[model samples]
Target chain A: AQSVAQPEDQVNVAEGNPLTVKCTYSVSGNPYLFWYVQYPNRGLQFLLKYITGDNLVKGSYGFEAEFNKSQTSFHLKKPSALVSDSALYFCAPPSNDYKLSFGAGTTVTVRA
Target chain B: EADIYQTPRYLVIGTGKKITLECSQTMGHDKMYWYQQDPGMELHLIHYSYGVNSTEKGDLSSESTVSRIRTEHFPLTLESARPSHTSQYLCASSEVYSSGGAETQYFGPGTRLLVL
Candidate 1:
């Protein structure tokens, strides 16, 4: 069984500042990791994924994630935050059988 | 536009009432899934279908039942609604890759249900 953890419940950052949302995972085999974002009252939208080869993956809305094997972490990062970037983010690990095990989610609030 | 749609964006019903949540995709994807989520919580997959008539239960134990009668439709039904079942239901669909590897899922707008 695979599991994911997002240590932060909420991350607040000033607009134009760099931001990071932490995520870690435990899986049996090679891991397939994903990042998703949800706006208020909406379903999750895929942001990025790390399947293999690349350690740093870039995604939509100028978001990126770094996959660190040694730390067992895949933290989401953005060079500069925007107020429009405020949303709930989730990190997920792929199940052996193609399902996804999601983290508890982290809400990002970009203050102006 | 290719899209996945979930009907009854907001539903409020009494406990013990039977209800069905409708989901459909026009993307011609062969895989469909249903997930339950509470506000500010993780998503739990309740059911999934690989294709028409191939529904399967997911990791989470759910009281709801689902069916895939058509390639584009997957509907979830609850025989008896309860307060515990009050949550946002998300519908998603994905195209299966021949390589037997990872695939990205496209999600609908989601349906919010409240059981009174």
Candidate 2:
């Protein structure tokens, strides 16, 4: 069994400011974590992933995520946010049966 | 680039209307999935395919069914769509290469369905 949680339903940030969307996960074994972004009425786009090694993983659109094993968290972060970066973000962990389980998703609203 | 495609980007139909949502991926991925979501909210898996001629229902008990005949095509059909079925349908395919059991999935634009 694998699961992910994005506690915040919505996050607001100003342009050029750093933004963080928190995520946490639980799995019986090793977890394969992922972050994805989705524009309005569009499908999910892969952003970054945490497979192994480094805890900090960088992704598309100048986004990055930190994987904290002790905290069991993989939080998405951006050094500088753009208004265009406002979208829905999802956290996922591949389930034991090869299915990917997704979080409820967090909507990030970047204001210019 | 991911070449996954979904037909009927938006569909509006009355209750009891039967419809099929088409999904095709050119990435030659063996695993394909169908997810039902309410915009930026929760996602529920409806169906998935391991390969051609291999389809299975997902954790969510759905009233729809899916078929995978060709490697690139996976179509979902609803015998009678209800108001509850009015949601967005997203299709995705994954390739397994990364470590720690990571498999990156590429998604299609998705089908927005509304049942009247």
Candidate 3:
């Protein structure tokens, strides 16, 4: 079974500052990872995914993640933060069999 | 943006009442999934369908039943709603690309159900 862990429950950052949310995974085969964001009372919105490619994968909204095979991590990052970026973010690892294994999720607060 | 949609954005129903949550996708995806989400917890998969006439239960033990009569439609039904069943139900869909083994899922706004 593929599983993902997000250590932080919440992260607070000032607007225009860089922000990062940590994620780690355990999978048997080649791991496929994804990042999603959810606003209050809304379904998750797809941000980006890493299928197989460069260690660095860029995603929507000027966000990017670094895939470190050795560490089994795919951390989401943004160069600068916007107050609107505040939301719940989830890190997911694919089952490869089509099922989605998601992390508990981390709440991000970008203060103005 | 993702073309998936879920009806009854918010519903308040009493216990023992029968309710159906509708999910539809305009992207013509081959896979559709239903998930139950609670506050401060990870989303739990409740049901999924590979295609029309195919449905499977997910990891979570859910009393709700689902049917996939058409590729675009996958609706979930609860015979008897309960307070325990009060949660947000999310619908998502993805296309299986022959070459790419990883399928990216697109989600709908979700249906929030409150069973009183």
Candidate 4:
């Protein structure tokens, strides 16, 4: 069973500042991870994914994540944050049956 | 953008009313999934289909039933709606790549259901 954990429940960042959302995984073999964002009353939108590729995976809206095998982490990062970036983010890894095992989710608030 | 879509963006119904949530995808994806989520919360997979007529229950125990009569359509039905069933329903689809691995699911706007 592959699982992901998001340590923070909420992250607050000022506009134009950097933003980071941390995620750690527990898996027996190769790791395939994904990041998604959800706006209020909307379904999740795909951010990015890592599947046997480069450690640094870039995603939508100028966001990127660093895959650290040693640390067992895939953390989402953005160089500069905007108020519109505030949303709920999730880190998910596929379980044995190809179903996504999603994290508890982290709420991000980018204040203007 | 993803080609998946869900109907009835918002619904408020009385308890014991039977309802069906419709989901469709035009991207010709082989796999489709239905998930239940509360506002600002994590998603819980309720049902999924590998293809037409191949529906499976997910990790969460749901009172809803799903049917995949067509490759592009997967609809979830609740025999009797209750307050506990009030939540947003999300539909997603993904294709298996040539590498035999599926990743990066595309999602719909989701249907918000409120059972009074």
Candidate 5:
């Protein structure tokens, strides 16, 4: 089963500062990558996805992820983060048959 | 926001009680999924359905069972709830392409279950 790995358990960033959350996946051909965010007491929301072409995939809330095939990485980045961006983020790659294998998640805390 | 919906956004129940988590989507998506997630943790897929009457177990070994009798509804049931079963249940739906691959999944407000 293919899976994604998030090296960071938590990330702290000052509001208005740049933020990045890193993820790597176990490779299996051309993979589809996804990023989802979960706010407190809510379900996971779709952030963005990478299927093919364009290495830089942009998604909701001013977030973008760079897909690096050589590094097997998909890193989510934001030029400036807001306090409202504090949430749990997940990087996922679909396993065979289209089931998502999610990473252990990274909690982003943007403080003022 | 996705049209997917989950009922009883929060539930607190006693051990041994039977509980059902209801999920419905207005998107008419062919692929639906149920995932178990602890607070601020990773998501574990428990069940998924390709379409009506096509339920499949996911990588996680869950005590809960799900049924897909209709394209719009997929409900998960725990015959006897336990403290271990206390967690958030998320419902998601996605459209299937011609190649049988799925696109991005849209989720509903998860149902949080607490069994004491």
Candidate 6:
């Protein structure tokens, strides 16, 4: 079964500081990874995805992720954290055969 | 801009009530999916459709049923609502490009349901 794992439940960072949210996955074949953010009372907004080619993928809101094949990890990163960036983040792995499997999620708190 | 829309942005209903959540997309995507999510929690796929008149259950077991009568419309119905069904339901659509799973999904605002 294809699954995704987000190790941290929450990550706290000060405004203007760099931030990182870790993610790993287990799949039988090629993996299709994605990052999504959900604001309060809203649906998830797609941030980025890694299908093939580039190992380092850039996304919306100045977010980026690095796909490591050997470690099976695709961690999201940002050069500088902003207060507006505080939200719930989810890492998902596409099953293609059925649906996408999401991680438990990680809450990012950007304190100003 | 092209988008997916879900109706009844917020709903609080009593148990045993039959309710249908409507989902429509204008992106002309062939695949659509329904997901259930609790507050500040992970998203679990409840159902999905490949195209019109095609539907399949997802990883999560759900009492709600869905139908895809039109290419751009997929509606989910709950025969009898329960307290456990109180959660946010998200509707998404994607255009499957190749068999390698390179499709990107576009989501709607979602419907928040509260079964009292």
- Of 5 and 6, the candidate ahead on DockQ is 5
Alpha carbon lDDT at B51, candidate 5: 99
TM-score of chain B of 2: 0.93
- lDDT by residue for model 3 (B18-50), tens: 999999999999899999998657899989989
Model 6 chain B weakest lDDT span, ten residues long: B96-105
Weakest 10 consecutive residues of candidate 4 chain A by summed lDDT: A95-104
Residue-by-residue lDDT tens digits, candidate 5, A18-88: 99999988876777889999998888899999888899999999999999988999999999999999999
Cα deviation at A69, candidate 3, in Å, is: 1.6
Tens digits of lDDT, candidate 4, B22-57: 999999998999999888887889899989889999
Best by TM-score: 4
What lDDT score goes with residue A34 in model 4? Answer: 91
Residue-level lDDT tens digits of model 2 in B20-57: 99999998998899999986687788898989999999
- Worst ten in a row by lDDT for model 3 chain A: A94-103
Off by over 4 Å in 4: B98-101
What's the DockQ for every one of the candidates?
0.62, 0.72, 0.70, 0.67, 0.70, 0.64
Better of 2 and 4 by DockQ: 2
lDDT-best of 2 and 3 = 3
TM-score of each model, paired residue for residue: 0.93, 0.95, 0.96, 0.97, 0.95, 0.94
Compared with the true structure, what per-residue lDDT tens digits does model 2 show for residues A1-112? 7888888999999999999999988777677898999988789999999888899999998999999989999999999999999999999888757788876799999999
Off by over 4 Å in 3: B99-101
Runs with alpha carbons beyond 4 Å of true place in candidate 2: B97-100
Question: Where does candidate 1 chain A have its weakest 10-residue lDDT segment?
Answer: A94-103
Cα lDDT tens digits, model 4, A1-112, are 6788999999999999999999999988887899999977778899999988799999999999999999999999999999999999999988878788776699999999
**Cα lDDT, model 1, residue B13:** 98
Model 4 backbone overlap count: 0
**Count of clashing residue pairs in every prediction:** 0, 0, 0, 0, 0, 0
